[model samples]
Target: MELTLPKKLNASQPITLETKGLVVIGVNGAGKSSFGKCLLDQYGSLAKKISGIHALFINNNVEEPISEEENEFSRLQSMITERLFMPRLSEYEKLILHLQSEEFEAAVNYKEACKVNPDLLPPVTKIDRIQSIWEKIFPHNRLVRKSGFIELASGSRDSDSYKAERMSDGEKLVFYLIGAVLCTPLNSLLIIEEPETLLHNSIKNLLWDEIEAMRPDCTYVYLTHDIDFAASRPDSKRIWIRSYDADTRIWDYELIESNESFPEEVYMEILGSRKPILFIEGTDTNSIDSRLYPLIFPDYMVKPMGGCQKVIETTKAFGQLKDFHNLESKGIVDRDRRTQGEITYLREQHIFVPNVAEVENLLMLEEVIKTVAHRLMKDPENVFNQVKENVIKLFEKDLESQVILHAKHLVRKKLETTVDRKITTVEQLAEHVEGIQQNIHVQDIYTNIKNEFSLYVETGDYKNILRVYNQKGMLPQSRLCNICGISNKESYLNLIISILKENKEDADAIRSAIKESLGI
Candidate 1:
C-alpha cells in the first residue's frame, strides 16, 4: 500500500511510501515522535504503534481470564497509554490465550488423524515462534510455558524459573516486543518508536531482523535518533526530520538519498545537521580541523571530510543535489603549494583555500599567538615577537628542503591534470607524454618557489611564512606555548578553545584573523 506523507512534512510535493517501509530519523526535539503519531492517526485501524519506552511490567496476577472483547478493549486502551501503563501485559495475555487455543485445536486434529497417520508433528504456536527468537537473543535464558503463564527459566533447570514480571528490564522489554509483534493484526503497519532503546548493539539488528521476518506481511516504520540503528536497515527509505512547527503543525524534513561520494553514516551526519554545512579536512574528531573549525565557525556545522579531495568532492556533490537547496554547503581545504590560479579556481567552486598551508599552521598566526598571550596576561608584543623569531629561524633552517617539496607538489599537481584520458591509441599516448616532457621545466619551478620562500623569510612576514609553510610541528617548535606560560601544544590548543567559548572579544579577534588569512 502507498502511504502519502503528511502535507506539512513537504508542502511542495507528496511523498509516497511503499510497503518496503521508511525510517524517519532526526535529532532530538525534531518531532520524530509527533510524525509517528501522525502516521498512526492517518492509517487508523491499519496501523499499530509500539513505543520504545513501553512499560515492561508483566502483570502476573492469577485472576479470571479476560474475555476476547475485554482483551481487545484493554489492548486498544493500552495503545494510547502504553508509554506509562503495563501495555505489554495485555498483549502477553493475548499471546497466551492464542497459544492455548492453538494447542487445543492441534490436539483435536491429532486425535482424529491418529487412525490415519499418528506421526504428524505438532503445529508451532505463536509463543513457540517467539521462543525460537528469544533463545537466539538470550542464549542462557529460555522461555517456559507453565500453568497457563510464560516464565523465564535459567539454562537446563526448570527449578530456576522466575515469573515474567520479575525479569530484568531488558529481558522483559524483549519479551514484550515479541508478544506485541505477534499479537499485532495481520498486514498492519507497525510503527516502532526508538526501537534501539534498551537494546544492546550486538543484538539490536538481529532482534529486528528476526521480528521482521516473523511478520513479513506488516510494513515497519522506525522513528529513531540513533543513526546506527537507522542505517542497519539498508532497504528502508531514510527521511531526516529537520524541524517541526507546533503552532502551524508543519514539519521541515528531507529524504536522505544514497550518494556515491559519501558513505551512509557520513551522508546521514550531513543531512542530520540543523545548521548550514561547512565541510573541512580531517580524519576524525580529534583532528585540529574538526575541533577548531566548529568553534571558529559557530554559525555553520563543521564536518570533517578527511582529505582535501574528499571535502571538495563532497561539497560539489552536495551543491548539485537540487533537493537540498534549503541547506547551504561550503568546503575549506589547505592551501598546500597550490598556485594562485588553482586557488582562484577552487574559490569559484565555493571551496575556500586558506592562506595557511595547513590547519595546524593556523595556531601559529601572529594575531592568534597575541590573543593567547594577552589572555594569559603576558606581553602580547613580546610573546609574539619571540614566537615569530623562533618560527622564522626554524623555517630558515629547512628553507631549501621546503622549497624542493613545494616545487615537487606543484609539478605533480600540474602533471596530474595534463594526462589526456581521451587518447585511445599508443601513438596518441606517446605524443601526449612527449609534449609534457618537452614543455615541463622542473628547474624553473624549483627556482621560482625558492625565490618566493626566500622573500618571505627576508621580509620576516609571519603571515606569508605561515601561508607557504607546511610544518605540522611549527607550533611546538616555535615555543609559543612556553612564551605564553602554557605547558604544551595540546594544552595551548585547549586554552584557545576555552577562550573562544568564554571570551567573545578574543574569539572574534581570532576568527577575524583566521578569516582574513583565508580571504573568506
Candidate 2:
C-alpha cells in the first residue's frame, strides 16, 4: 500500500510510502504526529494509530456493553481521542474474552485428537503465546491467570501475584502494545507514534523485533523524534520531516537515502543541525574528543566519527555536499606518528591534525597543566616543571620501543603509497616489488626516528614529546595529578572539563594554547 504525502510537502510529486516499514523522524515540532495522522486518515479502516501517550489504565473490573453496536461505537470514539479511557478498558476485556475462547477451542481439539493419537501435542493458545513473549521480555516476572484475569506474579507462590492493572506504567504499556498488535486484523498498517516511549534503550529494539516477528503480515510505521531509535531499523525506509507550516497545513519533508560512505545517524544529525560541522575522532559520547571538542569549538556541530580515517572521510563527504547543504565541514584527528609532510597535506584538506598524539595527550599540554594548577591554587611553574620531568623520565626509559614504533609507522605510510601504484604488466609488478625492497632501509629509518625522538628527550621538550608519544596512560604515569594536587586521572579530567564548562577565561586560555600549538 502506498500513501502519497500531502501535496504541499512536495509540489511536483509527493513522496509515497511502500508496504514495507518506514520510519518518520524529525525534531519535536516537525509534524511527525501530523504525518502519522495523515497516513491514518488516508488508509482509513486499514490503519490503526497507536498514540505515544496511549492510555495505560487497564481495569479488569470494567465490563463490556451487551449491545455490539454500543461496544463498537465506544471503541471508535476512544480511537478518535487517541485511546484514552473507556476504549482501552473495553479492549482489555475483549482481549481476555478472545484468549479464553482460544483456550477452550484448543482443549476441545486436543480431546478429539487424543483418541486417535495419544502422543499428539496440544496446540498453543493465544494466552500461551503472550506468556512466552512476556517471559522473554521480563525474565524476572511471570504472567499468571487468576480469578479469570491476567495477573503479574513475581514468584512461584500465589500470594506474590497482583492485579494486572497495578503493574507499573512501563509494564502496562508493553502488555497493552502486545495485546493490541495481536488483536489487530491481518494485513493492517500499524502506525505507532513514539514507539520508544517509556521503553528502556536495551529492550526497545528487542521489543519491536518480537512484535514484528509475531505479525509478519502487518506493515509498521514508526513516527519518532529519537534519531537513535530511527536509525536502529536499518531495513525501514527513513523520511526526515524538516519543518511544518501550521498556517498552510503543509510539511517540509524528504526521504533520506542510504549512503555507504556516510552513516545514516550522522547524516540525519547533520541534516538537522544549522551549524557548521566538526567531525572529530572518538566514540559518540565517552571519548575525550566527544567531551572536550564541543566546549572548544562551540561554533560547530561537533560529531565524533570514532577513528581518524572515518573523521577524514566524513569531513570530505560533508564538504562535497556543502553546495547543497550550505554548511562548511572540517575534521580534527590525533597527531599520532604523522610526519610534518603528512600533517601539511591533511591541513590543506581542512582536516586539523593536532599537536598532541591523541586527545588524551591534550590534557598534558603545558598551558593546560598550568591552567589546572592555577585553578588548584598551586604554583603553575613548579607544577609544570615536575610534570615535564616525570614525562621525560618515562619517555627515556621506553625510548627504544617508542623510536621503533615511530619508524614502523613511517615505513607503513610510505609503503601504502608505493603499493597503491598501478602496475599493468608482470615486469612492472616485479620492478615495483624490487623498488619497495630496495627503498625500505630498516636500520636507517630506525636511526633517523631515534635521533628525532632523542632531541625532545635531551631538551626535555614536553610539547614535542606529547606530539610523538602515543601512550594513552602517560598522564597517570607522569603523575601530573599528584603534582597538581588532584586525586587521580579521572578527577583531573573532570576538573579540566568543569573548568572548560564553568570558567570562560581558563577555557579560552586552554583553547588558544591548543589552537596555537596545532597552528589551526
Q: Which candidate is the best by TM-score?
A: 1
* Cα lDDT computed for each candidate against the true fold: 0.82, 0.81
lDDT of 1 by residue, 1-520 (tens): 5777765554677678775678998899999988888889989999888864554434445355566667777865755786566444554445556776776777688778876887877667777888899889999988887765678888787457877767776776777688678878988898898899998999889999989988888889999988888889987888888789887778888778878786666767766675788999987898888888888888898988888999989888877874764678889998878889988998987899888887888888888988988889999999999999998999999999899988888889879888889999999999999999666799998898889889889999888888888889888898888778889999998988898887589999988888887787
Please estimate how well model 1 matches the true structure, expressed as its whole-model Cα lDDT.
Answer: 0.82
Q: Which stretches of candidate 1 lie over 4 Å from their true place?
A: 1-17, 26-45, 55-120, 153-159, 241-254, 262-272, 322-325
Q: List the residue pairs that clash in candidate 1.
A: none
Q: Tell how far residue 411 is off in model 1, in angstroms.
A: 1.1
Q: Which 10 consecutive positions of candidate 1 have the poorest summed lDDT?
A: 54-63
Best by lDDT: 1
* Cα TM-score per model: 0.83, 0.79
TM-score of 2: 0.79
Sliding window of 10 residues with minimal summed lDDT for model 2: 52-61
Check candidate 2 and list the clashing pairs: none
